[model samples]
Target chain A: MAYTAEKPVPPPSSDELRARIPGWGADLDPADRPSFPRESLDLRPEGAHWDFPERQEPDGPRERSVEHKFLTPVFGTAQPLTGISGVIRRYAYDRFSEGRAAHWLLLIAGDRVDAIESHLKSFATFRPDNPITETGLMAEVKRHPIRSRFGRGRADLRHTWIDPILVAGPWVLTGWLVLKVLRPKR
Target chain B: MRAMTYRGPYKVRVEEKDMPKIEHPNDAIVRVDLASICGSDLHLYHGLMTDLRIGHTFGHEFIGTVHEVGPSVQNLKVGDRVMVPFNIYCGSCFFCARGLYSNCHNVNANATAVGGIYGYSHTTGGYDGGQAEFVRVPFADVGPTIIPEWMDPEDALMLTDAFSTGYFGAQIGDIHEGDTVVVFGAGPVGLAAARSSWLMGAGRVIVIDHLDYRLEKAREFAFAETYNFNEYDDIVVHMKKITGFLGADVAIEAVGAEADGNLLQHITAAKLKMQGGSPVALNWAIDSVRKGATVSVIGAYGPIFNAVKFGDAVNKGLTLRMNQAPVKRQWPRLFEHIKNGYIKPSDMITHRIPLEHIAEGYHMFSSKLDDCIKTVVVPNAS
Candidate 1:
């Protein structure tokens, strides 16, 4: 028996995927059952489409990143804006949800990826009421819908508080701005 | 009598030593009618596993006749034929209750890391092994399997480790009904994995190896299509071509080499590989799975003792399950399969010598000299 890119016992709904992603390459279906497109899972190399894409046609909500700019002041001067903007990806088990699951990110960093990681780690392992003091901000930002905008459409960034100016500014200013909002997604 | 004892670098001695005795109440003394060397035991031979102390007895694969039994022995009387599964378990422990008998705490809590087994190493269990004229079998009722009276010892001897290990490997590979399995390395364990793959209902089984003897024996016994790694410049590409470019639904890595370091490099490579973080072998096997495929590993591994990046596995949506085979859990079915002639896994044995001549058999088997697949030793046989 040969390795049919097609499974011998093909899933009944595989055709749904083919139909849904028109003109997408046939090889798009990864091995194994019920596979999603790599573009959907990895937001880095394929992040451009993880959210609603830039409107080339009638559309709303431009693709936005869950990643945020994190900054910490050294010697009382707030550090420059830096972080993996797309969000750093990882698996986060949700016991309440009833199964182990993967939490993904875009992870676009500016300079101190390491510092941001340490701060997150410290809060995760050391905090008393939970890690929300650290991760809550980032996690909330990640869950917020297209709060920032990029590319061609206002509808894409529609409702997102991400002002166009912030997207284009230097690392320091962006980090300062994101921190200043301090608004919870809720 | 000379014994296969671990000494130093490249030094396994056929040394003079005192014979072992039944130390536990459930113990039995077996006059080893047959025994075989194992690949894992080579770790001691090469001095990679430096903790076995001096003069440690080695060799886990064996078939013996019970010569004596302690007062508590009830399952079998003297003269009953038996094959000792590589590991010994007390049948009661947190691990045992979970059916992971190989990691039994009562029987092996003090000896090795997971649990105790014979002839493997200090890290496994420092127990004396059956590669001798006589061996002491602990937890005899659980460790010694009674072979039917009529079956050939050669055919029953391998029922211990290689077959079980390979079977476990195939089980890990998840060779489901009609699935195509690609097994890496055709050493004894790999051959066994291939054999088990076929028995597990795989539509096609492919065994990969650079060796000619193993490839041949794999086909003759395991019923696998063989791929000689030497024949192709690109093993993965060749494999894909054979599979029509999709890849096998499952792949098993049975070579069990800790190549990352000398003798025992601490299978950090394998551990790292598991994280979807390291090199190609594991990743290749993992990649071979049709998307969302499951990969199980039964290959024994040392602790990588570090962080693991499981992101790749998660992203690929692959589910991997691995553990040392709790042989006791599978013993009933495996024995039944043997009884019904459904599995002729023991036919791979190629050499048999008296217990006194075990040193030579070990050398031959270890060297893979003359295409030796499995070798056994007998003590009292004419």
Candidate 2:
């Protein structure tokens, strides 16, 4: 039989679409591109007209009524590995002791990461279409990533792990020396 | 006027009935020149559609000359030969607007949500059948097709519904550019589904059915590869073998109750991986599609609703589409495709009989006794 290639052909660019069904004005700008309704365009209806079974709606983040000394609270988007929005949302239940009294466990990782490594799936309450806006407990989840990493009173996460790497080896010593030599005197 | 009325189980009487008159502005009175028995019509003959009262006209598949047209009619005129799709449709509706005309709300309204079909049941909008001397057509401008002069009545008669439904089923099955599609039945709709798949550029079509006669016919046409489910205990083994071990990307379950009733019990107990099927073809579309694949089911599902396996369907990311044929909606494209050599759908017809002996034709077809594939009924009374 013939082979099925999964690669999708790129459709027209956003600029090209604007030329077709534009809003009432000319200089409506590039941001206005791709803003159209389902009925307005000849789009291929991808999903099933019928909803999938199971009807999974991931429960929202349970508020933390308790505080523990060793355990830190980690709150982030649902799944870290997949897209943030889907019918099913899964969050990693963190390791806890005694009466397990916490929901979202926020994990800090390499500062360059846009989202936590905890496998980000969308909170069931949040949808891609009608997104849970930048407010409430849901919005707080997003801001934590930006604020903790790069803001007015940001903590240097790099510094915390740097000393350990320095003590761990001869290769680390060579790296520190090379950087120190390259540094300009202030 | 002579009308073929349902007499009893497996019996119909050609008796006199008043000639139909156009009641609506969009209505057209058609003097039926040809009509045929559908596999679904057997559902009534066998008593599946039991609630039908006396004098129920027995056929829906028809093609005829328009005798009268209302003032609002624009596209058609009297004396034009036309094929009437079984499912009447309103140009507007969620189903029609999206091109799923067979499931139109206003047209097929049987006093329910999804709507009714002609000659099916009282539950299905009690529209009369075309298996009569004269029948009234609703939405005349959109309903009838002007049969091409060169085309044979045999080919034109098929466009009515069976061919269109099968074609629609094939279109919905998501055959895509180059892919292997497996069809479960080798009956009329199944064959059309196979042909439809080929037209969509399917690399190989694997058709499954028990009857050696139908299967041999399928094999002759290379209507995909054929599998005799009666011979083999496991249909899926041979099905997968043909698809290069990945299981077919698309599987068409056109055989409704023809498969097995007891198997349903075993399937429910077994795991989804071993199941390899949807109990009902129309509903279990998720079962046939490859993960993140598509399943278009045009086969008749039921007189009542049935539940679908959602857990497996969703986890696999299957896309399911069902309902009646998009006959009117696809008419223009279907006409173009047939007018060209792009699709030869009429090749499935195995029998052609005049209206007078339609009873015997129905008996041969409905009983599947003489191996009648599709019997086209022409009016000899004319």
- Candidate 2, superposed: residue stretches over 4 Å from native: A1-186, B93-95, B257-289, B305-311
Task: Provide the DockQ value for model 1.
Answer: 0.01
The per-residue C-alpha lDDT of model 1 at residue A116 equals 39
Please report how far candidate 2 places residue B378 from its true position, in Å: 1.9
Candidate 1 per-residue lDDT over residues B1-382, each given as its tens digit? 4455543323343445676655545678887777777666654443334223444677777888888897667787999988788876665445554556666554432222457677654335446787777777776666677887766776677767887777666666655566778887677778777776655566667887665767888888776789766567667787777766666788786755332211112233322122211233455566665557776665554322223335666876777866666554455555666766656766777766665554455445444455566666665556
Q: lDDT score of model 2? A: 0.52
Per-residue lDDT tens digits of candidate 2, residues B1-382? 7777654334455656777765556678888887878777765553334234434676678888889997667778998888777766555546545655555555431223334455664434456778877777766765567887867776677777776777667666655545667776677778877766665556556776656668877766434577666565455555545445455667676765323323452233111112222254433335544577666655453333234567877787776656666565455656666666555656777777666565566656643544567777666555
**CAPRI-style class, candidate 1:** incorrect
